[model samples]
Target chain A: MSLADLTIAEAGKQLRSGQATSVDLLEAVIERASFTEAQLHCYLTIDHEGARKAAESADRELAAGTDRGPLHGIPLALKDNFCTRGMTTTCSSQILAGYVPPYDATVVSRLRSGGAVIVGKTNLDEFAMGSSTENSAFGPTRNPWDPERVPGGSSGGSAAAVAVGSALGGFGSDTGGSIRQPASLCGVVGFKPTYGLVSRYGLVAFASSLDQIGPLARNVGDALTLFEAVAGHDPLDSTSYPGPVPEMRSDLEAGPKGIRVGVVTELSGEGYEPAVSTAMAEMLNRLAADGAELVEVSLPTFELALSCYYLIAPAEASANLARFDGVRYGLRVDGETVEEMMARTRAEGFGPEVIRRILLGTYSLSAGYYDAFYGQANRLRTKLIREIAEVHERVDVLVSPTSPTVAFELGAKTQDPLAMYLSDVCTIPADLAGTPAISVPVGLDHQGLPIGLQVMAPALGEAVMFRMARAVEERAGFTARPAMAGLPT
Target chain B: MPIEIDIAHVARLARLALTPDELDRYRSQLAVILDHAARVQAVDTTGLAPTAHPLGLSNVFRPDEVRPPLDVDEVLSQAPSARDGYFEVPPALEGA
Candidate 1:
């Protein structure tokens, strides 16, 4: 098999045994990325020389027996939002087109310390505000499954890179299903840890309360590995929880024996595409056959998740994004006065969806509307969390379809913003409640698009979530490679 | 709509200059969003307090100990316009 096709685990094994070198793997990945770049548009920037040097050093260290754990010498991609010292971290927006970070995000530092070779920075929705990568300032990332379909976003580029074997695995941040939704659409594994479990020190904030950094990989094990490498408390992030990071890998082999899986009644049926519902039903049956006790659980307020998320996230985004006023960094537009300069800079810099969200956020948080919009949304958020907590009391994990539908054609939902927002219906509640959730490819729809089965667990319940994901992944036996796998280099 | 002017007001608050076309588009879009978000009102939160954060964390202060800060050059290097060690911007006043 080609070195580019190996999972992080497989690549790490080869590198450790001296059967292959990091340089060889890095070259293969870079070459594959180059060949796919024209069609897939996965990366915002690929650091060829830096990656090569890092891989060479990794090989030298391995030769000297200075191993850096499972990630040592493994090639990967980072979603462009993370601050990588001296590397352009655009978040796929024109405002920061030429901006490079001065410091590495805590996750980037951790990944580097683990000796992972970051080959490139992947694309995303501009400031991670949109559902499809079509909103990206650069361009949309095409799904490897079909060139015409979108690889979901704002982490579309990261998920597409992993799906197409451009990278062994990649890192993407999830605010409202950015990682999981794209991973689902791209037919890969994506994990979104509980909000405070991962540090947000350098992740360009979309929604501070909802944003989290997670992993996307070809398999559950590889996703878990990437998650372990980056998940932990960072003193730099004040919101980071002080709890000890759980040993998730150790529990991978544990089956769903006697595990109670709560199948959320509200998440299934109606609104979901017929094929998606069928795939979900089959996956749930497989879980039941594997000794998992399936019980119908209800979170009545689930319908309010999307509305609550749209309000809270945009409000937080408006506040967080106010820093890019053209005074300190990024694009600047000349005006007669400072206020005019700020206005023109923002008008010229931000995209329409970003502007829409900022306007919505500002309106929601404005004086008279605060009690009606922002305050009401927060209260609904509390109710949703409470309802989810009550459900968890009876179940170990909640199961649902990762997305209401599989990957859609490009421009399918872009014209209608609310329709685009609905794509995240099943995935948003977990973010609202600060729970760990994962999307695993279960099967393909009738149209040959991949379907993702979502597994969610309460805060710090990654172990249970992983166990359930592994069970479903094993039973689904989904091994269909993207059609792009056959593309000639 | 009752809050059509709020779109322009919000844009100003956000320091974004929207064209007339954008203003019209956002005015309608924000109205729809607000209409949809109005569903939260049906929940009747009553005495329930709002949740600013799901994890319930508060007052996450770090030590006051001093640590190395970013280099001035590196920090200023990202600015579109910079002079000496400071970021350059338009004048604060029209003719100061």
Candidate 2:
């Protein structure tokens, strides 16, 4: 089998057994990354020399009888938002287009310490603000399933890179549905752990409260492996989890034999394409056939999740993004006066969607509207969390369609922002309630596009979610490769 | 309610400016945005407390401590404009 066909987990075993050297694996990945980047537009920067050096060091360590476990010699990619020392970490925005961090994000530090080879930095929506990669200042990432369709956003490039076998796995950030949505569109496994399970320091905050860094991999096992390496507490991130996470890999293999799966009634569908709904149903049937009990649960507050998210996320974003004023780090446009410079700089720096959110957020926090908008959204959020918690008491996992439909054509809904926002409705509630959720590719739509099945569990219950996801992934048997054949046009 | 969006006011607040035509465009677009957002006004939130965070995590803070400073030259490398040990920018106030 080709090196590209091996998941990170499988490749690690082979590398440790002397079946393949790190140099061999890195060469394959580097070639794939270069080939796929042109057609797929997946990466913002390819760390060819860095990856080679890391791979060489790993080989030396292996030769010296030192092993760094499952991640040793495994090649991977990172979403552009994560900081990498001495590497340009543009969050796909012109504002920080040329800025390189002097330090690494905690996740990057952990992954490197775990011996994972960093292949490249993937493209993303400008500051991770959009559902489609189309909002990227660089350009939209085409869906590996169908070139005309979008590979879902913010983490679209990361998902696309993994789907095309350019990297064994990629790091993606989830705010709303960034990771899951793209995983669904691109036919891969995406996992968002419970909030605080992953560190957010140096992640280039979009909406600090909702953003989470997670993994997009070829399978559930790969996702589990990467998650185990990255999820932990860091003193640098105030939101990092202080408690220890469950042994994810061991639990994922145990399956859902005794687990009770809940199908969220509200998240199922009205606007969801029939193919995706069918795929979700097929997974539920498979789970039932596997001796898992399926129960229908109600989260009545789900209908309000998107509404609550828009208000809360933007409100936080308005505050978080304020640090980008010309006085601090970021692009600055010069004007005759300081105030004029600040105005001109931000005007040129931020995109329309970002500006709209900032304005809405600022207004929502204003005296009159604070109680009306942000206040009400917070109340709705509490109700939603309570409902999710109540449902989790009866079920080990909750299932839904990751998104309403398959990838849409590029620029298809740019004129209708509401239509684009609705794509995240099913996935956003998990973020709102701080739950662990995953999107695993299940089947293909009528047009041969990929569809994703979502599984969610209560906070810190990622193992349960992954267990269900593994079952669906094994049964659904999705093997759609990127249309570009691992090379850019 | 503010019948029309004050483009200059919003632009100043957002650190942006709009031309007359762009102002007209944003006025119309922002109205639709507000119209859609107005749906939040109808939900009844009486007796419910506003949740600042979903995690129920409170007082999540780090101890304030001094750390080693960045190499001044490295820190200043990307600065658009800088003076000795400080970043230089125009100003925050309108007429400062």
Q: Which candidate is the best by DockQ?
A: 1
**How do the residues A1-489 of candidate 1 rate in per-residue lDDT, one tens digit apiece?**
678889888898888877899999998888788778889999999998889889999999999989999999989999999999988999888889989899999999999999999999999999998778999888888999998999998899999999888899999999999999999999999999998899999999999989999999999999998988888888899899888987676777788878999999999887899888888888788778878899999899998899999889999999999998998889999899889999999999999999999988988898887878778888888888889889888999999999998999999999899999999998999999999999999988877889999999998888989988998888889898786744653
> Which has the greatest TM-score?
1
Which 10 consecutive positions of candidate 1 chain A have the poorest summed lDDT? A480-489
Worst 10 residues of 2 chain A by lDDT: A480-489
Give the Å shift of residue A464 in candidate 1: 0.6
lDDT of 1 at A257: 79
Tens digits of lDDT, candidate 1, B1-96: 344446777899999998989999989988888778877777789877888768898888888899999999999988888997888887897677
- lDDT per residue for candidate 2 within A1-489, as digits (tens), equals 568768887898889889999989888877776676677788988888899999999999999999988899888989999999888898888788888887889999999999999988999988888888888887778887778889998799999889888888999999999999999999999998899889998898988878999999999888988998988887788888788887666666676677899888898768988888888887788778888899999888888788778888888888888777676567988987877787777778887777777777776786567877888888877777878889888998888999998999999988876788889988999998888899999988888888998999888887678778888888888876755654533
Stretches of model 2 off by over 4 angstroms after superposition: A483-489, B1-4, B63-66, B91-96
**Chain B, per-candidate TM-score:** 0.88, 0.77
